[model samples]
Target chain A: MKHYREPSIEAAETGKPSRKGLVFLAGLTLLFSSCRLDMHDQPKYESYEASEFFADGQASRIPPEGTIPQGGLRQGELLYTGKMDGGDSELFPFPITQDTLVRGQDRYNIYCSPCHDKVGTGRGIIVRRGMKQPPSFHIARLREAPPGYFFDVMTNGFGAMFSYSSRVQPRDRWAIAAYIRALQLSQNASYGDVSEEDLEKLEEAATE
Target chain B: MAQLFHPNINILIRILVGVVVVLAAGLGLAYYQGYYSVYFSQVNVFREQPVMFSHKHHVNGLGIDCRYCHTSVEVSSSAGIPPTHTCMGCHSQVWTEAPILEPVRESYRTGTPLQWVRVHDLPDFVYFNHSIHVKKGVGCTTCHGQVDQMPLMMQVNTLFMGWCLECHRNPEDYVRPREEVFSVSWVPPSNQKELGRRLVEEYQIKSRTNCSSCHR
Candidate 1:
């Protein structure tokens, strides 16, 4: 049988020290495992106040007062009363001009063509797909409507139509109304007095 | 003694793991609860006007148009609120004894415009035009509910993006002619779809359904 011997003092001391070291290491590992760095999370930029954004103060140019031309009818007032007050002629002046018609056409394409169609036939895609269909500018009643009436409708909103008062400026709306009148005339133009030169140009265009 | 020593080491390790788990769980519970409680929620807390001055009353009731009070609504970007003197135009001679008129009187005397609370307010990001709506024959009631009936006006409708879109999607269904625009008695035609179609054809009306029409 092997002789029984007491454990070495050095070994016993080192054994205890090693055990404590192991325990400390375990504790440290647990602590470290619990902490995490969130590298993916980032800070976002915040929106600034209006004053800060427009620091130059140039953004606050208040428009001059009394800019709207006078003699225009106000809201709730009738457009035109069929009276021969000489004002009636001024209200719906005859002989629509080429430049006026062109301006009107430009305005119509921008504001009206999207829904009313370029020809003012109300066949715009918005209408074709069962959307709200606007009346043709070529219609008799609308064709006869006074400029003031168009101006009023554009200023206020008619049925289903909300007001453009906030969308189109007053002067621009007036321009658009003038354009609508021009559209009506173009659709209703008579071929009775066509010049030979005009007719020849039309024929040449058609042939092309 | 040897058995006891190894078990003690194991027990220490177990306790260390348990403490870390508990700490993590506690932190997670706190974080989730705070997140669900709307940690970043903020309320708009600005003071606004109090009385609901009727654009309808001044426009329709007395036949005073929008320009009469909001003098620059047409020409300018802002359809400005009328000054105290605008109220004193008629109130000084008309309803001098009324209780509500007291504020109007005080504002005039003090040279301060009555801080009449604005009700139909939109977000600053939105670009709304009073002139365009007015020009289009859009009744004031479309956005601002029936003001003639209200003494002190409350916001009648939610001026939300969705609410505006609802009308925009089908404008002619709600549109009335120029003559009936201001009249409270005005009613949408029975055949709204047909009427819309007719208006689009006859009046050369434009569609407001597009995003750029209102948003841009």
Candidate 2:
């Protein structure tokens, strides 16, 4: 019978490895490439204890009610009456400039048109689908209302409407009100029409 | 007789093994530290401010309210940073000499706002309402930490999504009286569960367990 001789170290090291080395390599590959074992997996709590709501140490220092410290109108005027007596003095207070009307129209289409309709007719999809119906802008009371009044209704919200104060800023709400006024006027123009010269100018502009 | 191994081949193997080990270690360190910057590169980490603005000084010391500076917090999506004019209201006379007050004065003169770094930041996707939380008796300190004590405020709690979910899931377990909104002092409830039950019954507080309450 022929005797088998052990391979020399030089022969063993010549190529990759023996069968045992290949098995070890495969095992290491599996071990290192395994799914991650995360240690900080425990869920973090918001740390809001019930005691936080109670008058505890520094937590008890509650701010006063309705304390808007910045450039807003006082609550009674800005929120209720829509007057900007104490609002930012530098900015134009809600009578609606020519540019504001254009901006207001754009904003109205984006926000109010979905619920109030483009024509201010109150027949929006939400209304048509049997949700709460908004009052038409064509009504005499709303048509005659000041721009500030409309702004107030938009901010603090009127009956059956939740406050848009969260969604719309003070200035944007005023802009929408301005646009609503424009819509009201357009639909209700009366016998006191444009002068002949003005009409001619408008006609000439249209031709151009 | 021994066969000679190439010196370059041995060096190449050693270099390859070293590179693999280093790459593995780096990946492991990043995973361990919760370094998810790669995934959320767009997320702006809430930053700490340079100067210490004291809520305690204004709100507690001078009897000013949170609304004075954060006027829009209750009514708008953002708490709204106070313009320089708001700070000039009192600082105009109060702390004219303080070195830290110089930045504030400059901002007012230039009609610029102080770049007060925000500390409490929720994820962009989550919708949190300050007015609803304030009105519902959730205290500012519940999320803001001890702002009165913080010299230069840092985020005390991890404002993670799970953190918000926990309180929102169990509001009564966390809700307290509206008046105690700012106090850090804890006075144990005589009846904990009873208070929770009462709030649930009286306030008609629909379960915050609903996903849409905070998620939407």
Candidate 3:
């Protein structure tokens, strides 16, 4: 049987184990340790990853036309279109609860506050920058505008404002309209509009 | 073996062994640190993009909401990149002929999508969702760093598994109020530990340290 150190010259000559083979093996281990990315970056494409396969460097291709995504088939005429019988409906498709109003406020701040301002006065940062100034919700014309009119304006573009159909969902558009009604009420409120309990507090403050 | 070791060889051998041990330890430390350094981890590195979009200008200067451009961030896995139309929405009226905005104009004109280079690319095997993180009270700035301060977007953390495990094991260290999630300059209050603890319980943040929590 051949000895364990059969391959080394020094082992063959002197019978003493040589360190050369061990050193070479250690070097090989070190060389190979730093180089395996086989599982790190796979061949699959993420949402907006670049692709060499297509002429347009995009891995995410637009679905072929007539291909509706799940939930794309919109139901409810008033809900999706904000219209009923070929005209904007005055009533909300869903009831406007306090929660819906709060959701509307949150969405409004994110989407509309840039141009409409927090108080719905139309003098927002975007307007101050250069864009055309939108009419205030407190104006008499807008004050009397039905909820569906605001919904239609948001669903389709109004004068200088672009349609927010892409940025905001249909339900959110109605919620925003509800909030606009809330805003118009807040802005145009008079002494007669105040409740008896709230009026007592206002009366106390007014007297002070 | 006449004098295999001189009488003083004992001290020489001890000193030589000490030196070897110190050298080995030094090499080991260098290897460990080099392996995890930002250079290797892809941290704080800036990559060139087709358009030099600045978060500072859009976020801090203009005070535009993060949702304005990243519309699907709250609902989708991806914080949606603004299409050319979204850009043209403002630029059409704001800076009609600025040289810097020429690429935006061209893309809008030609209907070609502008290719944006991704900054926070995780390893393909790890699954991350923007909606889940944002919903669970992880502020955008928590993982994204002070994005409002970045002129050109750059990766802030190492994005290593070990770093992720630190948060996964204890979420109270980073959780915040849900309402303040999109706030660009949110400073953790002095009582963050207590506030964060309450938020973790309220938000139902599971200390998801299992391999599949992110690996899947």
Candidate 4:
């Protein structure tokens, strides 16, 4: 009120009305402006929104059959199905690298570790919560199983576990199979399996 | 006419004017606060979804990964919402008889999608890509909060322009190791300043405050 000098103190003396009420009214109007949300939410569909116009009631749609998205041509029978010449191939379709193993480890932790456990043991958090326990990767049968067998099981699913093909990509699936090999070695290996250089480091650590 | 009024009334009028001014100022403050409150912004307010999926039970209790259901978070713009089949993946085997999961089972059987109410819906004009944020080492919990702790999904950040600008302007304050992006209980270490700065540099995150960066 002090900031606004009377629009006319002389007018006040002459009995003219003040404009101060208009300023207060404008402030009130501005306050209500925040409530308007015409732009906050628009007429367009957001992801996974139910569509009234669509017959399926979904804003997203399933692609027609035989439609292949980019990089989705299911070529390389060994890579896609873990089989070649009508049998589960015992070799990886692509050469495995350190980066592939790292990526596999990451994906495995996210998609498989829930049921297979971080150590690839039968006990995971889900098993404790009542889901069926998966077989350990350390078992004799699984240890003797080819890398292709592991990839096949993940793509098609085993007895109790669901197929992860839709969740994990093909490259990552191969990568997880590779990581499972490394994990098996980690669990079943002895001191003799270590390299001389690494064994020396292990001995140093053991002494410490 | 009797001096138009009692001279003492002038003091009374002045006091009333002061009261009116103070009252108006208080009202303005309340209006501003109210505009940003949970009622208006929906921050920290949980909306009831159809099935009432609990992230706490799935994430913390069962150790399910965020990517277990939202599989495309790293590869696509929008984080994929799991179809009912994803829910049935486990529920069909474990919680097969639970009344709480009847809607999920029904959706799976009937092939009708469950209407899940979106929790972190941004304005239509703003373009947000989950993949870019994930690739740039912005942890899921950075914007979404610690979802493992939420029994019901809710908005944690205000999702306002000012709130986004905080990270966009200085990503070093929020960036984490790419490996830790999906981790539920990952806390910023004491050396977050150093680590985040390195990650921001390593991830090549640009300080994108241009209107075109978000608004198309």
What are the candidates' individual DockQ scores?
A: 0.02, 0.02, 0.60, 0.57
Instruction: For residues A71-165, write the lDDT of model 3, one tens digit per residue.
Output: 79987789988887787788999998999999999889888988899999999888898888899999999987878898999888887777889
Off by over 4 Å in 1: A1-208, B1-67, B71-78, B97-99
Indicate whether candidate 3 or candidate 4 has the larger DockQ. Answer: 3
- Every candidate's fraction of true contacts kept comes to 0.00, 0.00, 0.71, 0.83
| Rank order (by DockQ, best first) | 3, 4, 1, 2
TM-score of chain A, predicted model 3, versus the true chain A, to 2 decimals = 0.78
Q: Looking at the true structure's interface, with contacts defined as alpha carbon pairs within 8 Å between chains A and B, what fraction does model 1 recover? A: 0.00
> lDDT, candidate 3, residue A95?
90
lDDT at residue A204 of model 4 (Cα atoms): 97
**CAPRI rating of model 2:** incorrect
Label model 4 with its docking quality class: medium
lDDT tens per residue, model 4, A1-208: 4976656766568775556766887877886687768787788888887788888888788999999999678877898999877887799999999999999999999888887899999788878778888889999999999998989998998887778889988889999999999999999999889999999999999999
Q: What is the lDDT of residue B171 in candidate 3?
A: 86
Clashing pairs in 4: none
**TM-score of predicted model 1?**
0.40
Specify the poorest-scoring 10-residue window by lDDT in model 4 chain B.
Answer: B84-93
Q: What is the lDDT of residue A135 in candidate 2?
A: 85
Question: Ten-residue segment with the worst summed lDDT in candidate 2 chain B?
Answer: B38-47
lDDT of 2 at B13: 94
Compose the digit string of candidate 2's lDDT tens values, residues A25-141. 887775654344332222322212123344541222447987665865454445344666654222235466888788778667645765588899887654554436788999988
Q: Model 1 misses residue B21 by how many Å?
A: 27
**Tens digits of lDDT, candidate 3, B1-216:** 598888899999999999999988997788789888877877788778888889999899989989999999999989999898888777777878789889999998998889888888888999888999999998998888988998899989888888888878888888889999999889889999899899888989999988887877
* Model 3 ranges off by over 4 Å: A1-34, A196-208, B1-24
Quote the lDDT for B135 in model 1.
57
Which numbered prediction scores highest in lDDT against the true structure? 4
